[model samples]
Target: MQRGYFFSAEGGEGAGKSSIVSRLSEYLDSRGLEIITSREPGGIAIAEQIRSVILDKENTEMDGRTEALLYAAARRQHYVEKIVPTLNEGKSIICDRFIDSSLAYQGHARGLGIDKVLSINEFAIEDVFPDLTIYLDIDPEVGLRRINENADREINRLDLESLAFHRKVREGYLELVRRFPARIVKINANQKMDEVFEDVKQVFDRFLVSMGKLS
Candidate 1:
C-alpha cells in the first residue's frame, strides 16, 4: 500500500496560496491521483463553526489567547474528523494552511509567544505533522496591494491589520523555514502564475518520485 502524504501551502495574506492550491489540485487530479483538499479553520462542519467565531468581525472583543485556543480547537477537530481518516484511506491531503499560520499570525505577530501557541497546538495535534510544507514567499507590500486590488475577497479582521503585523508573519515563516529546513520548501510566489505552478509541481513531483508513488 502507498503511504499517505500531506502537503500544506502557507503564506501571508494575498500571497496567492489559493490560486496555487487550486491549480495543484487540478494537476494532481489530471494525473489520476486521489487527493483531498482543505483549508485551515475549516474542512469539517464543526471546524467551520469554529472558523466563523474566529473570523467574525463582530467579535472584536475576543482576547488574543482566546483566538489562539480557538484555532487550535478547530484544528484538532478538523484533523480528527477529516484529515486523519483521509490519510488512513491512503489518499493525499493538501491543506491550504495549517499550524504554521497560527504560529506566525497569533504567536509571532499578535504577541502571544510562539512557544505558547505551539504548546497549545502540540496538545491539539499530538505528533501528526504534515509530510511537506510549501511556503509561498512574496513581498508584504505587493501582497497587500494584491489584496486591495481584489474586491471580491472577504474582509477578514486580520486583513485590516497594519503592515508591520503582516511583515512579522512573513518573518515568522522565514524563521520556521530555518528551523525545519528539510520539511519546508520555499517557492517564489512573486513570479507569474505559470512559473509559480511549475515551481510547485516540481516539488510535488520530486516528493512523489522519492516515495515511489510515480513510476
Candidate 2:
C-alpha cells in the first residue's frame, strides 16, 4: 500500500496562509493525488471548540503557558481523530497550521522557549510530524497592513497583539527554519498573490519529486 504524506503551511498573521493552502491543495488534486485540507486547533468538532477558546478576544487574561497547553490539547485531538485516520487510508493532507505555530507563538514569541513548547507537543502529537512544512516568509509590518485592509478576516486574540509581539513571532518562525532546514522550505509571501503561488508551487513540486510522488 502507498503511504500518505503530510504537508503544513506556517506564517504570521495576514501572510495569506489560507489562500496559499487552498491553492496548493487544488494544485495537488489536479495532479490526481487524493488530498484533504484541514487546520490546526479547529479541524474536528472538539478541536474547533478548543479553537474558539484559544482565539476568543475575551480571553485576554489567558497565560502564555496556558495558551500553549490549549493548543497542544487541540492538536492531540485533531491528530488522533482526523490526521491519523486520513493518512492510514493513503490520502495526503494539507493543514493550514500545525506544530510550528505553537513553537513560534507560545514557545518563542510568548517567551516560553521553543524547546519547552516542543516538548509539550511531542507528547500531544506522539511524534507524528509533517513530511514537509512550507514557511511563508513576509514582513510583519506588511502582513499587519494586509490584515487591516481585509475586512472579511476575523479578529482574533492573537491578532490583537502588538506589532513587537508579531515581529517576535516572525523571528521564531525564522529560527525554526534554521533549525529544521531539511523539513521546512521558506517561500517569500511579500510578493503578489500569483508570484507567491508560483514560488510555493515550485517548492511543492520539488518536494513531490524528492518523495518519489512525481517524476
Candidate 3:
C-alpha cells in the first residue's frame, strides 16, 4: 500500500507558498490521491481564534515568546484535530506552513533563538515532523514587492516586519536546510508561476516515486 504523506510548503513572504500549495493539492487530487490541505494557526475553530490574536494588527504589543507560544498552541490543535486524523485515514496532508515558520520568524529573526522555538514545538508535536518540507527560495525584495502588488493578498503582522527582518527569516530557512538537508528541499521561486509550478511538480514526482507512490 502507498503510504500517506505529510508535506509542508514553507518560505518567507511573497515566496508564493499559498499559491503553490493550491496547485500542489490540485495536482495531487487529479492523480487519484486522497489529500487534505491546511494552513497553520488555522484549519480549526479554536486555532483560528488564536491565529486572530497573533495576526491582529491591533495586538502590536504582543511579545515574541507570547507569539511563539500562541503559534505552538494553534499548531498543536491543528495537528491533533486535522493533520493526525487526516493522515490516519490514509490521506496525504499538505500544510501551507508549519513549525519552520516559527523557527525562522520568531526564533531567528525575532531573536528568540531557533533552538528555543524548536523545543517549544517539539514539546507540542512530539517526534512528529512533516515527512517532507518544500522550501520556496526567493529574494526578500522580490517577494515583498510581489506581495504588495497582489490585490488579493492581505497584510498580516509578519508581513509588516522590516525588509531586513524578512532577510533574516530567509537566512534562517537556509540555516534550517543546512541542519536538515535530508528532510528539506529548496526550490527557486523567483521564476514565473508556470515555471515554478513545473519545478514543483518535478519535486513532487521525485518524492512520490521515492516513497513508492508513483513510478
Candidate 4:
C-alpha cells in the first residue's frame, strides 16, 4: 500500500503561509498527483462552526484553555471527517496551520505552556501527528506590518496582540523545530514570493523523492 503524506504549513500571521500553500498545491496538482489542501478549524461543517466561535470578536471572555480545547475539538472533527479519509485513499494532504500554531500562539504566546496544550491535543486526535511540517520563518514585525497593509483582510482578536506576543510565538515554533528537527523543515519567508515558493517546492520534492514517488 502507498503511504499517505501530510504537509502542514505554519507561521505567524501574514507570513505568506496561505499563498505558499496554494502555490504548492497547484504545483502538485499539475503533476497529476492526488492532493487535498485544507486549513485547520475547517474542512468540514462542524469544524467551521467551531472556527467561528474561536474567531468571534464578541468572545472576549473566552479562557485560554477553552480556546485551546475548541481548537483541538475542531481539529479532531476535520481529521476524522476529511483528512483521514482522503489520506486513506492515497492522497497527499497539505494543510495550512496545524498543532504547531496552537503550540506557539496559545501555549507559548498565551502562557499556557506547550506541554499542557499538547496534552489536550494528544487526546483530541489520539496522537495522530503530521508526517511533515513546513515552518515559514519571518520577523514578527514584518509579518505584522504585512497584516496592517492588507486592509482587505479580516482582523481577528489575535491580530490585536502585542508585538511581544508574536515574538514569543515565533520563538516557540523555533523550539518546536529543535524538538522535532526531522519532521519540520524551516523556510525563510522573508524572501521574495517566488524565492519562498521555490524553497517550499524543494522541500516537497525531497519528500516525494524519499517516498520514491519522484525520479
Best by TM-score: 2
Give residue 160's lDDT in candidate 3 (0 to 100). Answer: 87
Query: Which prediction has the highest lDDT against the true structure?
Result: 2
Alpha-carbon lDDT, every model: 0.89, 0.94, 0.92, 0.89
The better candidate by lDDT, 1 or 3, is 3
Alpha-carbon RMSD of each model: 1.3, 0.7, 1.2, 1.2
lDDT of each residue in 1-215, candidate 1, tens digit only: 66577889999989999889999989887766788899998999999999999999888888989999999999999889888888888888899999999998899888988888999998999867899999998888988999999999877878878999899999989988897888899999888879988999999888878877676
TM per candidate comes to 0.95, 0.98, 0.97, 0.96
| Model 2 local distance difference test score | 0.94
Clashing pairs in 1: none
List ranges where model 3 is wrong by over 4 Å: 1-3
Candidate 1 segments exceeding 4 Å error: none
For residues 101-196, what per-residue lDDT tens digits would candidate 4 score against the true structure? 899888988899999999988887778888889999999999999999999987887888789989999999999999899999999998888999
Q: List where candidate 4 sits over 4 angstroms from the true fold.
A: none
lDDT of 4: 0.89
